[model samples]
Target: MLTEAEKAATLWIQTGFTDRTVIQAAVAEPLLAGQSVVGVAPTGSGKTLAYGIPALSRLVPGAGLQLVIIVPAQELAIQIRDVLTPLAKTLGLGFQGLIGSANRERQVKKLREKPEAVVATLGRFVDLLEERKVVLEEVKTLIVDEFDSFEPDALRDILSFRRGGLPKQANLGLFSATDNPTIVSEFQAAWPDLQVINETSTDNSRGVVHHLLLDRQQAGKIQVLENLAREKHQRVFVFFNHKHVLQKVASELRFKHVPASMLVTDGRQVQRAEALQDFRSGRVPLLLTTDVAARGLDVADVTAVVNFELPDTLTTYIHRTGRTGRQGANGTVYNLGDDHDLRDLRKLVGDRVALETEPGEKKAYRKSAAHSAGADETRGVERQTGAGHRPGKRLTSAEEEAASAKKRKKKKQRWRNKKNVGKHW
Candidate 1:
């Protein structure tokens, strides 16, 4: 029987139409009614607890792996494991992470001992499944967190696990920070009657101020970054597009004596984890990263998000900017781009944000004068060279005409040579 607190929690879950509200509703309604359920929520919205609290409340005392949460990155798996550990302890439920970077032998050994809930990434989870190391037929709940990041291939691998034949009405929860229309539509088509609770509006209540910096050249952008870094002195996340560019920018900052670190996918797992830890612990004030840090990973106390290089896609832009201003903190996003680039970004952000120009600044190209000077020099060269002659040389009209006649004679000779060679062959 559900306790009064749990019942109230369920009621709270059902009342709001936000992402968190919807998730609470799904968890409570299904468990209360003895039916399986799925809950979809945004990133950083306490998704782990939304499903975890209910799963723990409903689990049999020593049941093993009754709930399995699959995430895209190892960082997310570790994060989920951390969130569930205390709750599991209170409920006397066992929990273990089946992440890739961790010791596989140890994970398998832990599995041998039978844990109640297992959090894992898709690749490693599939590996365990293929090895017959985990039995999912008894899995009461399967929560696929960040389903949008799960490519079709990963989803296919997950669907194959159903071959083990789970209960006819097992709970399936797909959670994401983004409510991609295409993903939602496809998901509904697949499940037909899957209940969806849109929580994007509520999830965005975390107090993030978005800004776009336009008409800034690469040099000017670097200056802005330096100024902001010195002024804020808070932990910052600078997102870039290419790995090479990420490293290059970090190197440039270091050259300028700026304390900065970088996290890229190509680095070893330990290195990446250390970078993240340093940034989170505030030892490193600035973190330059690729999209590897954009999704699912949680880093509290980030003061600002600097898009050193703008993301090409809207989803990516949202995720990048969403990193800061999390948990109701007043965080700002600085989008550094040229005018053309800002236009593209504006289209992505739509009317959600208004573009504001920096006050007391005139929009002018500093290189225009230099370009005109170069054009004048080229014209001077042309005047010296005369009409039919190449630049950098003076030629009289008679010399120019003679040169043209000589060129024509050479062309006729070349054509004759080609014709003779063809005839002889």
Candidate 2:
């Protein structure tokens, strides 16, 4: 029951994105009829093709740049361009992969040439807009991919583009696998008439991901990741919250002959190119990165994702693990963090985390992760005691009085509750 254009669209997909809900929903009249779309679909669910096909199909070649795609990271921009550029060339449509590290002068020259589409990192795109006379007057569609993970810099560039010379009538689309309620609220408030399309799997996770936790310190976590990389084959994305930690982990891995590379926002172009080449070609087996690679970065046979540190929020956790277990394929994710991280994860996702407690040596690992759910009250008490306390100084007059009063009040409240329970018993 495919229309001619739909059939043509499906024919262009080399990645076998033929039977996805996103593709169907995107091509429907509503989306093509200028209804701004907020597509919340699972990772590896053909989200790129869902929007890309329709966007490309609407392209009138040589009509000055018609489509503008904004991605959060440089690598994402490069990856999307890799997917769309060939298809564009096939259709006689021109597009440019605009990146900051790449030749900006050449990119400007391409902008002057007015490619039919521009897949750009938010920072580079903004810089180009300032330095060059790029025309957005002919732009008809605007796409912000990975909306949740957009950094402050990217968001700033997007706000400027939204309020700047770009036509108000341009079709707008915001897409990501992770749904941030705050961002969703903001988008809805901004575009009251936007059509919100959610095809995210009933269970947010796609593959048979093992929601696991490794209760280890920072050094121990690196060792665990190394063990995973050496044991099971294929690429592994080891994520750290801090860049310093990421680099340190990578250095340790390399120092121990584990061939680890750092993939971060500020990584050099040559390094990025080599890292991707090695990853795709199986030359480099392990990549240490920050949240930069969390969303929409595709590498074949990335069977697992390792969280060197548990992400701060549930949204981040979902996306980080969503990297693996994509497209109904089986994958695994191992999260490493302290007791609080494990507890918070249990609270947020419930039993979605299938913490693996293997035989032999992993018995203790299982025990370490056992009390995650029940440790909440204890953790809370620890936080109150250790938070913001100076190492070698007594509390000031005001602080001493406040601390004593607070402790007294807490003690009294606990005794009262305990007495009440005793009376009932």
Q: How does each model score on lDDT?
A: 0.65, 0.66
TM-score of each: 0.76, 0.78
Consecutive 10-residue window with the lowest summed lDDT within model 2: 416-425
Q: Can you write out model 1's per-residue Cα lDDT over 164-258, one digit (the tens) per residue?
A: 65554556667766665666565554445556666666444475453534355565455445555554448788889888888777777786666
Where model 1 places Cα greater than 4 Å from the true spot, the runs are 1-43, 361-425
Candidate 2 lDDT:
0.66
User: Between which residue pairs do clashes occur in model 1?
Assistant: 19-199, 65-115, 65-116
What lDDT is reached at residue 46 by model 1? 63
Which pairs of residues have clashing backbones in candidate 2?
none
Best by TM-score: 2
> For each candidate, C-alpha RMSD in Å?
17.0, 13.5
TM-score, candidate number 1: 0.76
For residues 204-290, could you state the per-residue lDDT of candidate 2 as single tens digits? Answer: 436455555545555446545555555536678888889888877777777656777677777788887777777778777787778
